[model samples]
Target: MPEGASHQSDSHTQREAEEEILAGLAASLGVVLAKPERVALSGGVFVEVDAATSDMGVVVEAYARQGRLKGAQPKKIAQDVLKLALLKREPGWERTRTIIAFASHEARNSISGWLARAAAEFGVELFVVEVSEELRARILDAQRRQVMANADLLADDLVVQTDSGR
Candidate 1:
């Protein structure tokens, strides 16, 4: 591949990985994954969310990077900022919770402090997989909740089945 093509390929691969991770995280949190999903606002207009959960009113923009934080911080911040800006312009979308999920917090540790501050100021959440303590905790909790919910559903179905059989 040419030098430019190689770079483009890498970026595309990184984005795919990031999108997958974000989708899984969103699923764990009971959110449906739909990229560029169109949602009808209070008005007759509709808006596109990068990934949104209809039930929870949450949207996420994910970023994946393989380098040290110093080289990527500004760009990542800019991307998050832009996403936030677009979401906020939609009438009711501003009320929707926004998140910027990174692939790994440690990968961005060099600018972790700055990211936290910027995310907060921008009214968007910042989370990472396999790195941030908070992200792990949230994932674990969501998993537990999902399992318990499934158990309940299964039990209820079993009871209904037995009663009908009798």
Candidate 2:
């Protein structure tokens, strides 16, 4: 295999690890909350959320990409917008609040400005959170075999198009 392909695979794995840790946090949050709510996965998105209700609901986007890389900023925004779009379309998800959990404030701040603006314009509430130890542990423990199942399909499309164009 080419060195480039290996690097791509490694990056993909890193993303999966980051996403797993965040998913575990989301799961544990559901368990510790005072109010009763069901934790479930979005049909099209990989991460889980408290099931949507007429009053309120929560969806999580584990933004694993590092924020410091300026080159990645645009791609990250597009990725997040796609996730938000899915939530926006869900029936009875109007009241659903998207809690975007980042590893740190810097991570959150890197994309928060854009996300914050999106929330106001889109008429939805978007929140940024720091990953606590307990949340991190829960995410670590919750790692699964195929976290990339959904994302891989989309990624494959990009790869295929690139390969064919070349």
Candidate 3:
């Protein structure tokens, strides 16, 4: 390939990688939001679903910041999304009955501790998922499957199941 072509290919590859990373992040968030479980992470954050009547459930949200970043911190993002989800009440969604997963990897211990206390005050359970190489690969694979399934559905109106039920 020519030098220009090679450069173009590299740029394309980098863009694709970034897209994939963002997609994986979104997918991880989606899975956590969908599950109904009491979970909390080191950072001040929590997720909980109503237990008594199963009709009214709310996910309390909180987060801590360590360094400079943009937009909502991890915990704040999770909380905001959960609140939106609760308000929207998307199809097949029950009452807000899950602790939103908080992103605390970037926050300092002190801030995290404060956030944790705040989450506790609100009776929210915080959840944090450690990201390792293997975990990342798994998340990517799941995202790919979802994309493929969506594509197939759009093309042929068929539901594709990637899992073997294992």
Candidate 4:
């Protein structure tokens, strides 16, 4: 009902979908994965991957959108690639298998350009897993709701500007 409430709800929904996709990927890969502790980076920096094996052998970053990415979504994929690449640079993770999993073909295709190529060159595998129709529908609905919420917020801002004679 309030501004940003829908976004918060949509974010929760997307996170749930991402967890499901990660589980499916772990099952398909025959490897157990969990959110690992903050991985060390240079200069005492740290980062976390969505999932990884106990040995840090298999690391993953998952995206759970149902359709083509919009706005800054592509940047998120790029950030994932960078995270995996940085992880690879860490000792003992040089040989780790890194992945970026998607929940839909359309979402994957949205980055099938230079970003995809960069990911491949960085050794970040991209995959599309088959999710339940219900889950897919839920994600789509969330997307629609988020869009409408954004539009409503914009309209509200315009009304405030008009009232203020701006």
TM-score of each: 0.55, 0.46, 0.28, 0.89
Q: Put down candidate 4 lDDT per residue, 1-166, tens digits, no spaces.
A: 7866555235778888888999899899999989988777877898888888998889899899888899999999999999898888877778989999999999988987789889988899989888899888888888888888788988999999999995
Off by over 4 Å in 4: 1-9
Instruction: For model 4, name the residue pairs that clash.
Output: none
Q: Can you write out model 1's per-residue Cα lDDT over 1-166, one digit (the tens) per residue?
A: 6655432122445545656667667766766756765656555766554576755377777655433455446676667655665666676566778876666665445444655576677687766644344544544454355456667888999999999998
| Winner by TM-score | 4
Q: Rate residue 103 of model 3 by lDDT.
A: 29
Per-residue alpha-carbon lDDT of model 3 for 1-166, expressed as tens digits? 7655432113343233333433344365553222236544334554453221123343333222222324444455445444534433444434444343322344323234555565454444454434445444544454455456656666663323333333
lDDT against the true structure, per candidate, is: 0.61, 0.50, 0.40, 0.87
Regions of model 1 farther than 4 Å from truth = 1-9, 37-49, 54-56, 108-115, 131-166
Where does model 3 exceed 4 Å of error? Answer: 1-71, 74-97, 102-114, 131-166
Work out candidate 2's RMSD over C-alphas: 9.4
Question: So what's the TM-score on candidate 3?
Answer: 0.28
Give the per-residue Cα lDDT of candidate 2 at 80: 60
